[model samples]
Target chain A: MKVLAPIAAHEELEMLAAAGAEELYCGIVPREWLERYTGAVWLNRRSPKGGSLDSYAELKRLVDDAHKLHLPVFITLNSPYYTAEQIPLVLELAHKLSDEIGVDALIVTDINLLMRLSQEKLACELHVSSVAAVLNTEAIRFLLNFGPSRIILPRSVTLAEIATITRDVGQQVEIEVFMLNDGCAFEEGFCSTTHHHTVGAFCTSLSEMDTQFEWAGKSFTTRRQNWLRRNLTDYREWVWYVNGNGCGVTPKGLPYGPCGLCAVPDLQRMGVASLKIVGREASPFKKLASVKMVRDIVNRTRAGVPKLHVIERAKQLRESPEHCAAGFMCYYKVDESA
Target chain B: MEWSLHIGGAHELASELWLSRFVEADRSQLTQPWSELAGRLLVTEFGDIRFTHCAFGNEFCEHLIPSVSALQTALTAAQQQQLSFTLLTPYVSNEGIAALRPLFERLAGNGGGEVVFNDWGVLNLLRRDFPTLIPIQGRLLNKSLRDPRVTPMYATAPAPSSALNVLQRSNLDCESYAALLTGLGVQTVETDNLPQGNDLSFAQYGLRIATYAPFGFISTSRICMAAGLHYRKADKFQPGAPCRHECQTHLLEYSYTNSPFGNRDQKFFLKGNSYFYAHTESMLHALFAQIRAGQIARLTWQPRLPMTVAH
Candidate 1:
């Protein structure tokens, strides 16, 4: 398996590549788009503030530099869907990235955009974004008609489901799974809530809401309501911790969000092609640490380490035994019976 | 415009008392049953409408997919009521697809009914093998902005018009998208009555529009909170964990206090794995107007909050 890390700036290229990142992906929103759409109408799913490169020149430099290190860079245009008027501008940007900037592939989500790409036969490859929410093998087979070389599975899918999907279609298309950082409470593709910095994410704001419970058209007792409220609060907190405690990092310079290092053996055995490290908007240090940690685990797995020892080694790197014990930060559910 | 009553499972169809009331109720006086189900008076104007179709099946969770026997019960009820049957489906894993295939086969053999698909794979399945079944794009596939927080900001915020347009617009406005759906054998698309309002001008694309009322989904999750309401803390948030259908019995209402989006009294309802907001009276009035103008061809009414079977 290869390590696909997020790249934002040209300067972070050397550090990430040195940290064992074989592949790189980033989002770029042009100045012209910002002047018009003003970041609210995101060209990509990410906020344009720090999540994306703001100029084509910067993207060109980053792509060129990463290619020199034998690393292929992918660009994200993975908003859930694009309107008719926005399609022309998006296609223009896709063309420039594929033709001029020499990007390796375009990570896309919109079905219409994928159809357009397929129709135009763009030079670069098309990797279906997780935002497209291709959860089933039938969905993968359906998407195969569009000719995407890779499919990034969503965070909502379980390890068993991933194994099934890869087993069914892994031979036809490369399968990528989220291995580290930034987890979503809901399936990102099905989530239609806006993610602007102004309004924040819908799920994050849910934790602050007061609750009332009704069953069969009657209110629950105060004690029961309060108990359920606590449960709901705990659930929200768990979701927050799994989503990286608002993209938090630990004292040891390791990321504090969702981790799937223990599942590396399962993913590798299932013929998974790549392990994606999310967070294009993360700080440079967090990116490097994430890449290094995943690289070490992959190396251990490749060296024929026992699966149990590899799982323990991965848990030790987090420096948070309580979270690992609770399985609060697990991206893929670990089978205890195993 | 036509009307359709959407229920979640076979139990709702088995209620002879409810079925009789729904069939014989006067259009102008039909709001009482819906209001009683919602715990509040939801729709005020029915405008001499009558339900001509009955839609069953869950759109958010694959676990809630109706079994083969349930599908038979729903089809029998629809036939007895002289209404067309529409089968609803959710985004599924390979297992979900497998579970739905038998139901699809039943529907197909029953002489073809309308099937609403929320996932592209399901649509592909229908087009490929179950070609006899009619495909309607489910509301979940209608990716438009339905966030309640941002809906209120559309009037007060000083954001650019283009930014707001992005919020108010949806794939329906795209000709290519409409063409794609039409190419895939879809003639009607389902959408929510968004609080920010909708532009149904896309009806010119020769595609009919079906809008759901009273409740619009804000978001859905595979990490079902309702399913784990009784589980231990360590196992509470596990994705794809088995459940006892706790969502069918409990309904949660969330109200924001000291909300940063101002004092709009934002309230959301959590049912099953989805969060929804009740449509305002003004939004319903606009929807009625749209129906009158012939822009909306169908109104799918959700009497209950989650559109699930009564407990």
Candidate 2:
């Protein structure tokens, strides 16, 4: 269970560690936080030309060329809340990424910057962000008193709620999950909207908007609300449906979004130590064909194979062919009897 | 400094003249009885001390799990309305904290209950196992920006002061983030009356805020397209399927004409699944002049029910 990915540059670190990427996460935003929060505040949740990195000397040479190939970089001060003059420039860039560019973990998602990095002990490894929704096991025993080593999780739970949180706290912490690109139909830490200026990612413009079905004491020009809006014109039965379907992008176009690779054999029998792969503003050759297609489906689920031939070898490495039977570009969903 | 009446589901038409019922519902229409609730509700007032979601979990909509005989008949009708109960949680998973340990031991033996935590793991499981209830802070932890397509462009422009300070600032207006939510005993914070307005300056961080009104949930999803329209299979609308509650049967009215400043009539409301934006009475008379300038001490309100009613 290790693919992680998403590094933004320093020449995409040896093609994302020669297209396997054991671990790499990123986000930097320098140039004085894009000349004073120009993307209307964002030192993380991307946008300094998205998937940041404009110096800490190019994130100390992309964490010294991905820690000479053993990977491990992490670093996205995942914003879901951060103000108080932007918390001392996000705790002076988390104390220069933990005292001058050493970063091995900081993902975060503002529970007041995880209680100010566990009340300023701030050494490094913190993780927690799927914008900190955490989802159960009492929010991982309430972020195990903010000494996180990993949490990610929230893509709105269920793989039997991630096997009821890695079977109860899966040995205290480290869970990670979303094995591929963006899928949120809202729940990124209770989505407060404004994902970026100019209608872009407010949950993908909340699926091309349009609604009105009033009647708890009438009037939207009630005639049974105009015959329930001209016979509910079937915008695929709304509630912001969304299913454009894309196993495509990145000729520097970059959006090979939503791809669970049929839930990597139940997130490796729910041990899920890490799968991640979201596109920190993608395209390092679509993050090297999504870290060589989830490192060849996590090495064919560690070579034990047969989860229906690793989901027909992850539907022939996602040329889809209706493999995940496209349930809105499903990520973990793959049941019709596997 | 308190008005409350959120009631998310069928509490025999709630109303006993305020003082609480953020009573949302889910664990099967929260033990129904507002004339057998199958949605289409809208009554007001409060009392019969009820505020629910025992285990505080909801990304935006999908609740109702209460059963310990429906929290012992909603705690014997909130101890015959001597009222002192509140529980609306969400964001839980150690199997929803082992299925909310018998509704946190029935709100820790009901000694004046109250528990609205939008998951700081249920305020560290009510500060290590229900230390006699009372936590309050859930408006999905109030992250702000409640977008009904940019609240009509932050209600007619002039919002670029870093987008009106990230839409009326709040990390509980930092004083060490309100002393780390009042050192976790969390005195109260649940707010959201923002149709592009609300600078009740996090009521200077001392906590005790409580605002909510006319629907303020900008996001929520256990992947329900109104409980996947009786599943003729569109991935059976995802999240553990089989929900016949059908957003308590109908309510999905969205209408945003692409406002990235293109701006046009933007109305959004969808009952019982989550997506709302409706607060004008001059935004409740500017939240009643910030509840008579005490900078909002409590309001809660929410009329237009059936997001499966259980606040």
Candidate 3:
């Protein structure tokens, strides 16, 4: 199985390669305010609502650089609900990426667009975004019917569930298991902390819109900045739930528990095609070290090369005493005309 | 709310039968036999009245003319000293909205509380063509806005009035039994039956069902539309081994009950009880009678139609 790590800068990519990342998926958003709050005020400027995929020169450079080390690149054009107008722009961008950038695959969720791509033979492979909510092996099969090479499973899936799916559907398509720094259940794929609560806009339709939502009295607008502020310079959680105790269906970042640092061995046993790390705000140094730790463990574990020693290495590598659990990006279904 | 009497005739009450408590249970407590004493429901607990089309899948632009006529007739039939009708339009193309201009012309000189608007394009057009049509963002808009965290059923109303920009272009739809029935702060909610979370399918859940249609259908709409009454037991496949997939042509209509068992049983079923939707609608209409009974500043519709009784 190949392992992919999402990186922001070339520095991050270099660190990922040193860490043994199979592939690198990156985004085009400023990272500072992100450190502050995933608050509505902070928007991905390059891909505003219905925004086009960022140009390939920089992304291509990253991909080209990764290729030197034999690492592949899967470009993310995943967001939700492109208006009827954005469709042409998206198809055009898909063409450029497939024909020009030579990306390994384009991770996507939009059905109408996917259906269109099913007809045209494109260059890059298509993997359903986890936000498209492929939960079971049956779902993977249905998605495969559309002819995708891979299916990004939902973040909320348990290791047992992953294994079951891989057992049933693994031969049909590659399964991508998340490795590190997924904030919310899945699609909220960023590093989450206790100090500042970061809520991912799983619902991508309105996420890009410079709009606010009015529901049940308190309105949460995407564009309007929230006045409340807090600081979380310190991070600690084992004070809450016992290991394997509250691991079932708890949202990340509660007062009592450390967020889920999950079952990598089980994922390996399940035999996923790729081990992906969902990186959002991890410092390049931490990301590098994290990648190195995970890659070594995966290589050792998969090859039957010193398994316990790799576990020991993982324990020491996962500083902050917090384990790193990986999962898929959350996708929502708000296609313009689903 | 528990009531003393059952009311309404067959055709009208068929939709209300799902509210078995009000229609069926209330029958035991009534002094009058559904005809005479039922009339008191109008004077007691009803407010502004609304008449809507029998909601089915995808009413196209072409259906608007007949829909308008149906709207008028249903409105006239529903008229009483207190009852005023709300013309419910289906989601149609902008051309569908344009067609309403003539209908609006007929209703203009004689105006009342606005015609509920759901389509954004229609909302834009109606503001110019028939300002009186009173554009309200229907729950359909909210359905399209698939924010799982924010359900129309949760808080019971659209956020607060402050969250809304309520210019003339805005009237809200607080659908009856909407996710949050009382949460949405719409001027009024059109209800057939209280929304049961069962068989609820939306664009989001659609993907979940692609692999298992019966479960998908159940998660979407509880009642089967075609059979009119019955629940599906298992998720059905599109074709292949079962039934030769013959039902694929009219999948939406017949697919609701397409069982994986194939023809093993004379009555294999899955996903929804469309008849339940029917019974629930009538049940809701009677409940609407109780809900609409109190308002002072609106036209109300509560008189039972003699022609449509549940047989």
Candidate 4:
């Protein structure tokens, strides 16, 4: 499997490529779009401030530099959906990125945008974004009608579901899974909440709110309610911890968040094509360390290491045995019974 | 205009009060014109709202999909009450799809009905195998911003008008989006009574709109907190874990004291796997005005807080 890492600026190219990134993806919001829609309407799922490149020239430079290292570059246009007026601007950007700047593919989420891209017959490959929420084989087949060359499964999917999907449609299209960083409390595709820095994310802000539990239209006993509240508070804290503790890195400079290294062999056996490292808005140092961490596991899996040993190596690399033991940082829930 | 009563189970269809109100409205509708039906609107409460159709099934969690026998029972009740039936479906995995195949077949075999698909896969299955069933795009797929926490931001923020417009609009605002649904054999689309309000101008695209009132969902997840309430810390927050439907017996309510948007105290309800906020009276009044103006074709009334009710 290939390592797909996030790229933000032209300067991060060499470090990420040297760290063993086989593919790169980024989001760019051109000046014209920013002037009209403002940062409030994001071109992608991330905030437009640090999340995307500001100009076409910057994107072209990044694409050219990555191509020199034999790394394929993909651009994200993966907002849940675009309005009628916004669709034309998005289509024009897709064309310029694919036809003019020489990007390898466009990672898109909206169904209407996909249909328009397929009908227009853009020169680049179309990789459906995980925001499109392809959870089952039938969804993959449905999206296949529009002709996406790759499908990124949502983070909410289990390993068993991933195996079933790849088994059914792996031959038809390449499959990608989230490997590290950035986990959502809800299914990102179905979540319609805004991610603006001003209001913050709805899910994260939930921790600050007060909670109460009622059963059958009556409040639970004080003791049970207290337990439920504590459970909720602990769960939210764990989710926050897994999401890089507000996108923080450890003292050793290793990125800390959700990790899926233990599932490398299972994914490889399932014919998965790529392992994606999320966080385009992250610093270059964090991005490089994340890529290196994933590259180590991919290499171990390729070297015919025993699955149990690979899992053990993955746990050791995280440097947080307690978190691993608690299973708070697992992206894929590995079934021990299996 | 038409009104539909949405419920999660077959037992809701057994309520004589609900059946009597719907049957009386159906009888009055046989003689009254469609335009005059708006005058008979009584927005007192869910019990008073007259409906012409019944929508049954879960729209957020596949684990809550009704059994085939339960579906049959609901269908029979709808038929006996002389109302149309619409089956609501959620986003599902392969296992969920397998479980729903028989129910879809049963619905299709029983002289066909409307199916509200929250997932594209379910829509694909309907178009492929259950051709007899008409598909209605559910609100989960509408992709509209329904966050109540940010409701005050739209009015107080220094953002441009275009940005706010994007937030207020739904996918139906795009002509190609509506056209795509129409091409998929969908003549109707569903939406929530958004806190920031809605723009029903998409009705011009030859697509009818159904707006759910009183309770609009903000977000949902497979990592069910309700399902794991009794599990240990190490076993908590597990996605796709089996449960005894604990959500049916409990509801979590949240109140935010210091909202970044404004001084208004924001509140939401967490039932099962989703979080929802009750729509304000002003929003409901606007919805009624839109319905009276012929923009919204249907109103799906929910008597309960979450669409999923306790037995």
The whole-model lDDT of each prediction reads 0.82, 0.66, 0.38, 0.82
**TM-score preference between candidates 1 and 2, better one:** 1
In model 3, state the lDDT of residue B28. Answer: 17
Tens-digit lDDT string for candidate 3 (A1-338): 77677666655666677768777775543243233223222122122212222345676787788888888777665543233334465677678777887777877765445665676789778887764545455445545656888888655455556777788878888898655544331112111101112222321111122221111112335432221100000000111111111222213221111222234555666788876665434456545655665676776677774444555555455443332221111111111221
State the lDDT of candidate 2 residue by residue for B1-311, as single tens digits.
55544443335334454223333332322122221221122232122433322222233443444545555565566566544456565655555556666876876776647767777776887888777777877877877667756554655776557656666765676678778778878888877778777776666667778766555667765665656555555455565455666565566655677775665565566555466665655565676677666776665554334254332
- Which residue segments of model 4 deviate by more than 4 Å? A336-338, B15-48, B155-159, B307-311
Which candidate model has the greater lDDT, 3 or 4? 4
Chain B, model 2, TM-score against the native?
0.34
B140 Cα displacement, candidate 2 (Å) = 1.8
Stretches of candidate 1 above 4 Å error? Answer: A336-338, B8-46, B155-158, B307-311
Q: Residue A295 deviation, candidate 4, in Å?
A: 0.2
TM-score of chain B of each: 0.88, 0.34, 0.37, 0.87
Poorest stretch of ten by lDDT in candidate 2 chain A: A235-244
- What is the CAPRI rating of model 2's predicted complex? acceptable
Clashing pairs in 4: none
DockQ-sorted candidate list, best first: 1, 4, 2, 3
**For every model shown, what is its TM-score relative to the native structure?**
0.94, 0.35, 0.44, 0.94
- What does the lDDT read for residue A172 in candidate 2? 85
Clashes (backbone N, CA, C under 3 Å), per candidate, total: 1, 36, 69, 0
Docking band of candidate 1: medium
What is the C-alpha DockQ of each candidate? 0.55, 0.24, 0.03, 0.46
